[model samples]
Target: MTSSPVPDTPVEVIVDLLTKAQDIASYCDNMISDLFLAGQTLKMLIHMSQAKRVLEIGMFTGYGALSMAEALPEDGCLVACELEPYLKEFAQPIFDKSPHGKKINVKTGNAMETLKELATAGEQFDMVFIDADKNNYINYYKFIMDNNMLRLRGVICIDNSLFKARVYLNETTDSNGLALREFNQFVSNDPRVEQVIPLRDGLTLIRRVPPCKITDDEVFRGVTGRFILDRMRLDGKVAYVTGAGQGIGRAFAHALGEAGAKVAVVDLDGAKAETVVEELFLKGINAISITADISKSDDVQRMIDAIVSKWGVIHIGCNNAGINMNSASEDTSLEEWDKTFNVNLRGTFMCCQAAGRVMLKQGYGKIINTASMASLIVPHPQKQLSYNTSKAGVVKLTQTLGTEWADRGVRVNCISPGIVDTPLIHSESLRPLVQRWLSDIPAGRLAQVTDLQAAVVYLASDASDYMTGHNLVIEGGQSLW
Candidate 1:
């Protein structure tokens, strides 16, 4: 078991308030953030992240607010969200007594309203601490991500994540426990990366998966002229994603379908592929699902034939399905190496070759492959010698085909992403290593699957007709260091 934490700064304010509030008939300690739990961690996290602005969803007793304020830089700001106005009065004298009190601003009333107001004003935060009503935990997290209120390198800490251990236990009628359980599961499936520290009530730290500034606002600025815009539209194109069942591949399937292409969602799992087809149908996009293993040449050929027969032509091919297995160089077995290579390199080759034949006959096609940052740079701290080497081979394969096919009206390209926050790293074994990886990244975040949507669209559309034999890397500059 971990030892209880001691604050780096003296919390004389907490001592004073507890001593005085004991006699107040309206006082309650249940909502207070104790130093033994989330209190001290918030201070250390702020200091480590060098956060300039912090948000506390519930500021009872001003202990959490004061502790975090003490950790902020001299110019830093801390916005406290509180529902009860009387607590501010009780905590005001204690706040006035501390030197860091000037940095704290307490906003009283409904927190949901405060959040909406902040959204309207275009506010963002480096750190957000939530210790509010349990029922609203999931709602708060969703709002923060949807509104872009969290900075690229920012983190959100949720207190009482374990909810007295009911979150992991059998079903409970306790509304608080049930809500926390739902919140934990929801975050697990989210695009962001998170880690839960078993600090008494459990503190979960979450951060965005990707870093990029090219949003709709930039597109809305009319950077693309109407004259050349037609080249970017995929109105009559036919596309297919090899791993269209879920995660990044699923996202690419949706993106290409939405871009006006008839998509064939291909995956090893027939049910998953069919589900994606249903999603496309809901969006009024003509689509189909093909179950095939890219490693098998027959399967790959059949998958391609089905698409060509349905659409009468294949204009775009997204070879996005791949796998990774980590093992020490000396310990990597031949079976492990072959499995990694079979999918990452050989499987991609078969898909490219089969799709190239159809495109070569038609005299036109765009092939987008999925590569990894590991292909270019060794992402250390986790040993995956085979996985890294296989991806490097994929880059070479893409360049080989791209140059050969360029003169034949077939453009081949690959997209290399930084360590994406996918289900691959959600295992308990990889959690600690993910934390180390985050610290080394300059952008301080992983790439969300959504971050790569537009990249695939560009490579598939005529906008990149002249660009071939290129590796479009969307990694958040993690390989630079």
Candidate 2:
């Protein structure tokens, strides 16, 4: 059995320290060390008694620094490097209030250069916390070790070593994922480090071994627009999308067309419909474009007809269009209220009704609706009464239709996106509110378009055949609040 935690420190002391650490880390000005975990403080402290001098490389709000500083003896000292002056200024008071404040020194500037300077000054540490720079994690570790910043028995803690657990998978493509994968392998084989912790994102705890170095062998390296189209076949299949003239809609149309489904690109602008169709024809996706207000029936009907006349069937329908007014109930206008629902809600229902009929006959089809986390929770700093209400309606609609069409083979589902970095979001209405709502997002930023692709692919593929009427909330746990 594994040995128990040290009995010298009271559990309550650890809990209080961690609580303060979390509060300080959560400060808005410091996004650098935003990935630090409070729980890791307890483990880090257990290994900290051996060190009289501790250095924390990334001191975002001073959470990691504070936690490690508190564990140091009266003669022990901590040097924390924070690049942002505002963050340093903001966090200084928090540290000043701490009992170990006198023992901690806050340094400001580029962490790589600062750490190098400290090494040049013969500054060594018994413990170090490396929690910055995803793209430079491997390089940073090498620099810290090459300069002998850590004594042979010194302990080093690296946070975000997992990069959202993406590195463990095979399909990782982003820089963060690639860098983490490389770092993990480097640490795993580096004779200098004994163990690594695969915590939340990831954390590695390594004890310095003299004459050992992190080698290069471990060094690893790692848009839309809308438009028109025409359906080629429907024999018994149907497909539809909102905002189809540009961005993700155009991408989805090409994908579905290549698969042989008669696809419809639904857009508010008629000209966009024609343009999208032309692009699809060039790619051979059997696609067409229809200009219709998603919220209005007559408009949707014209587009629906284009698909029916060409393919004689409807199978896949996508509710992918939405708008944001960015107004609270008091500030929101009746026009904004009606307009948002008209497109996201009324339009979704109109398309569902038209496609539901065809699917009821065929007894097999798929309907994918796009919902938003604004529907599930009240997002802060950025308020959009109309947008939130409309998306909420889409969720209930999906569930209701899913129940009605389950036996009919028509799977109805919704993809609830968090704040996606889309053109619409970048529109005049949303840009002002981005920075306000960003801090609330668990993922630390707006959702990327690529982030939504997999969720859509999953819902559209046969892999989700057995799944129906499910509201797939993909907002990066924003609703967890």
Candidate 3:
């Protein structure tokens, strides 16, 4: 939802700074340590560690200094020490162009005297970078440790530790190479945690050893972890699905049974419900069938009683049975309006109340209602005032029961699905209506019954324990348009 941050300058200034630094190195009489990617590396380290106060012992062309400063917070500071005064003036022009230039304080003098001055000033740093003369590497590290100049969680980085691999191979008699070899040995035996990365010319990262270090046996003492996949499993649960004869209800029943719950398929058509139960049996799932019309209050109560008698408990109640009658607003009959509400909204409420009693007594249950995308947006090219209003009422009813039952160990939530490709919509008369709907759907297609399987399982599982009073809309971005 948020846009990428714009650069504080007119151009990609970091790349520009590196380009200018590389050009200056080519024309200069003195050699600058511009070979390694120290600028970007230090910048990444500063951002990761959130280092507010940085100490850069040697900043050649001010490229690394400016990079570190850029990563710092607005009020952060970086102290750049150097042995020569002329190099400060050479890099100052580039620094002045940067917004972070104010964060850098260039100290021109002998490096050791500047370190002593900072120590006496009662200063501490979150990060310390040492890339100066190799001969004084040990002395700089020693001063930092002995004076307590580094914070307890501070990081100290040493560049060029391998010294062109000469320290490890011992192939050179050069003074800088020999000094680096000794410094590497000293750090290897020190009481700290360190890692040497072969990033260009050996970058060594060191941090203070943590006290009370973690042990293998203590990793999971008196505790266990069930990861996301395990938490999603609905093992040892009992579930019953209304209108499980076919379509979305059939899918929800099969999904719940496949997830290790004993399932009962309820429907007004006894033969169709038995057929679906037979399909579940072929898949080695334990299931039963019950005939009941949810629109009747007695039938709804009988449906819940039948499930509890078979499984001894009901853990999941899926109220997915509903009907829609398409008609013009003015031409819609009172019979059609009442019929839609009786089955869609009133039946759903009856099922919720009956199942909610058993769940409240047992201290746990999940009820999932099947609402429609029509509850959110008016379906174009067709008018079904009663159907749309009933579905909207379903959503409101779900929110009310969800909040009321949440504290009593019963969770209620609704799913609003887009137009689905089913046998009911596979007619010649509805072909033009389907085409008009596809244009409104951003995905350019209708949702399949299988497409909504995971959503039902998520609501029925322990994974959605923290969620309540929610309307989960799965409309393929149709409602947005």
RMSD, candidate 2, Å? 21.2
Model 3 has a clash total of 0
Which lDDT tens digits does candidate 2 get at residues 1-481?
2233543333233344444555666552233233234535633564444578988777776655666666678888988888888878866776676777677898899888888889889999887778777887888788877787778667877877877778877987888889889988887888766765676557677886544333423221100111111122232345777787876666666656665566788888879978988887887666777777877788777777777787777778887877667776898988999988888898888888887887788887788888878778978776778888898999999999998888978899998888777677677766788887776777778877667665665566555678888988877777885
Better of 1 and 2 by lDDT: 1
lDDT of 1 at 70: 88
Q: Rate the local accuracy (lDDT) of all candidates.
A: 0.86, 0.73, 0.85
- Candidate 3 stretches with Cα past 4 Å from truth are 1-224
Query: Could you give candidate 1's per-residue lDDT for residues 1-481 as a string of tens digits?
Result: 2233443333664754453554463343543435434567789999888899998999987888888898999999898899999998977777777788888988999888999999999999999998999999999989988999898668888988999898887858889999999998898888665555646677888876553335555343333532244557688899999989998999999999888999999999999999999999999888999999988889999999898888899999999889888889999999999988888899999999999999999899999999989999998788999989999998999999999999999999999999889888887778888888988788889889999999999999988889898998888888888
Residue 163 of candidate 2: its Cα lDDT?
A: 76
C-alpha TM-scores of all predictions: 0.54, 0.49, 0.55
How many clashes does each candidate structure show, in the order listed?
Answer: 1, 25, 0
**Model 2 whole-model lDDT (C-alpha atoms):** 0.73
- The TM-score measured for candidate 1 stands at 0.54
